[model samples]
Target: MIPPPSARPFLDQAGWAGAEILPLAGDASFRRYFRVVEGDRRAILMDAPPPHEDPRPFISVGEWLCESGFAAPAILARDLTQGLVLLEDFGDARVREHLDAAPAEEMAIYTRAVDLLVDLHEQPAQSGLAPYDRAVYQREAALLTEWFAPAAGLAVDASGYTTAWDKVLPIAEQDVAPVVTVLRDYHAENIMLLPDHARSHGLGLLDFQDALAGHPAYDLVSLLQDARRDVSPAVEQAMLAHYQTRAKASPDFEAAYAVLGAQRNAKIIGIFTRLWKRDGKPRYLDFLPRMWGLLERDLAHPALAPVADWFAENVPASARGQLDAGQSAQ
Candidate 1:
């Protein structure tokens, strides 16, 4: 349900005569996107549905990312009143498409992606233009309680989750690592495989409106433990090694990694939950077990020792089973 003030431009603009616009399939979020072609040129038309969709943050973050050398979609033009944007087309080949065609070549792609992550993490904390503070993280986590927990049909552990949050915040605050403006949704689906450029040498980035200043491990987890797609353990470990080697630390880096992974997964659980109940997108619910498995793997580490105890006391044992049942019923 969108008004046409935003899209009327293509028909009106001098540069875009004969422009044909096609509605593109959208993700779980409220935003709607279209592919526009005028002559040989191609671009995207964005519509952030009103009241439910706010363009301010998305616009601000998009500008910041475009300036920062990350491969986010560029804003060619905007109609703020109608919440629309004309964006550069990054081509349609998502990394998932590439990986699917040649699944065995994931190693080379992993290496390249790991290199991209290292470059992002190496940016200094002062370089970050956004911050992922407690309010942001907590809001994201609440999505789980509100969305997934109900779907799980387990008693929402309001107090227990609060207690777990209390247990982990100190460890997170002690994160001495410098922050970078993280593409909070950085992952394979958002990355494109472009050719003919020295950089990427040809990778494109998309769907990064929620950029934040956060730990180095956040984006890495986002890539390696994606909910929409699965990354093999071998590839995950190889990428981790690439990261460890790139960062060359003074103290134990593994400890930092474990805590960050747990935190990232915890945040994602809530997001997926929210995607289901609030957004009416249930595909993400299937990824809950993968995220849970990540949590369990992370908890095996000694750095998550206290958090493990907290998790054991809370979060149900039949967690995966319940989610599966929910999925089938849905």
Candidate 2:
């Protein structure tokens, strides 16, 4: 779609002369972005669905991050009435796309990436971002039953799964860690590797409009338990240890890792299923089996034993067969 006439009002209010629009990616939700070239300068044009997406938080987060000396898009102007935002264009080369050819070398690069996550979370968030409380946790965890239960074609023992989830859910709430700004989608796909820098860290940030005050472990899980590609056992282990040590997690590290991994991977399974069935993108279905494997491994850890045995008993045998079919075709 062309740059809507509605955006012109914002440009006029800010005294920007022209707008040139080009197609940009549509990764999730109903949000779409355009690369707008006006005069010799460039900026990103955001098209968000109202009521579904209010630009209030996005604008607030951008301002806060900019002041804190983090890398974020510059919000040149905004049209709150039309849900349009003019932002500085980052670039097209995402870290994941670049790593496809040689993933082994990503170890050093990814370590640097984790440091940035540390930076974002180190501060006690003052931005009025909502804490990811019990309600949100339960709602996200329920996606596994909604998406995976039907795909696996299992009606085995509903009570078993429910009871097990009841056991695991409370543990996630045990540590009421102080809230910090979390980049909810801090992974290779959303990050862009700045290869030209004299002292390159990792990817320059992008798509951080939905920042929230949440647990530190949440972003760590998003990075390590990635849904796109297989982060090797050696690499994943190294990262787990690195983060745990740096965070000064002493005796509880092992148990925490297991519980966190299991919880996150379970969420991914449901998310992939929803992406396939409801969102019309079966491509995400390919990631299901790998996430299943990770969950099973975590289940072996004593921290997750209550839920693991229940899953083994309840999740159908047919699940592996169907999920493997999707991956094989891919």
Candidate 3:
């Protein structure tokens, strides 16, 4: 793969000039990743073009994770003006792919993942991070009405959607859970398994640039109610129990989890729809059914009664399934 011309000077300054650049992956955003190899030396090149993405949050959070004894990729070098950063390579053992290859290891690997969160919550909150407050919550949940509803050919009750969130979102903001650094996208696909590291330090964290100071339950919900993959109900329950036991979570934690789960799933449904409609990426439509399934389960929780009622009244059962790829909101 050819390195972007802007990357040449950055790599040279980082002493990685002439390294072979191989495309690694790209996510739901404008950012792209490439694995840089120069003989025995290796690192990751994060190309987050400006006006669309920034690398500072990523660098800040990564450095904090390393200092806190976690496994976030280290930032080796940076050129913020061009939105390029050199990060320590965490290798290719993603937890999602790992579990796919060895289904029997699901319980064990997930146990470790839960333990990692338990340990992370023990640290003091990282100062200067954004607070995942009510406004952000309401705005995110509105993605469903703003994008998905139109695409599904249903004109949703947008105001009622906000009102429902206004009622139930406070349950998540309750003092029942500790406020900690919430890795907003903590899920199987973003976690790496480092074979050389001990079990406690085995999992490598990624995509945490959007870290926020929020209730500890938010990240846990993100992990259990994953949008990309179906984490079995049995496994989800077990992990939730495991997290509660280890973290000594409050009795109200489950309520918070359900609320956040519904909120996040709504946001994701909107985001995936936006990605397809606005960004021209139809592959994300494939995950809509799974997202809807997870959202429905969360809505069943008593904590989500307000939001559930809104969805029931607005988004009928028929409109809550797979979206038509041919439909466009543009």
Q: Give RMSD to native, each candidate.
A: 2.9, 3.6, 1.3
For 127-181, candidate 1 gives per-residue lDDT tens digits of 4456777766666656656666667776666666656666665555566666676
lDDT of 3 by residue, 1-330 (tens): 455689978998999989888998789888999999999998999999998999999999989988888888888999999999999999988999999999999889889989999999998779998899999998898898998988888987799889989999888897577789999999999999996666345999999999999999889889988888789999999999999999998888888899999999999999999998898888899999999999999999998998899888998998887877776536
Task: Please say which candidate is ahead in TM-score: 2 or 3.
Answer: 3
Models sorted by TM-score, best on top: 3, 1, 2
TM-scores of the candidates are 0.87, 0.86, 0.97
Please report, in order, the local distance difference test score of every candidate based on alpha carbons: 0.71, 0.71, 0.90
For model 2, which pairs clash? 192-203
lDDT, residue 104, model 3:
94
Residue 95 error for model 1, in Å?
0.4
2 or 3, which is superior by lDDT? 3
- Model 2 segments more than 4 A misplaced: 1-18, 102-104, 156-159, 176-178, 195-202, 321-330
Ranking by lDDT: 3, 1, 2
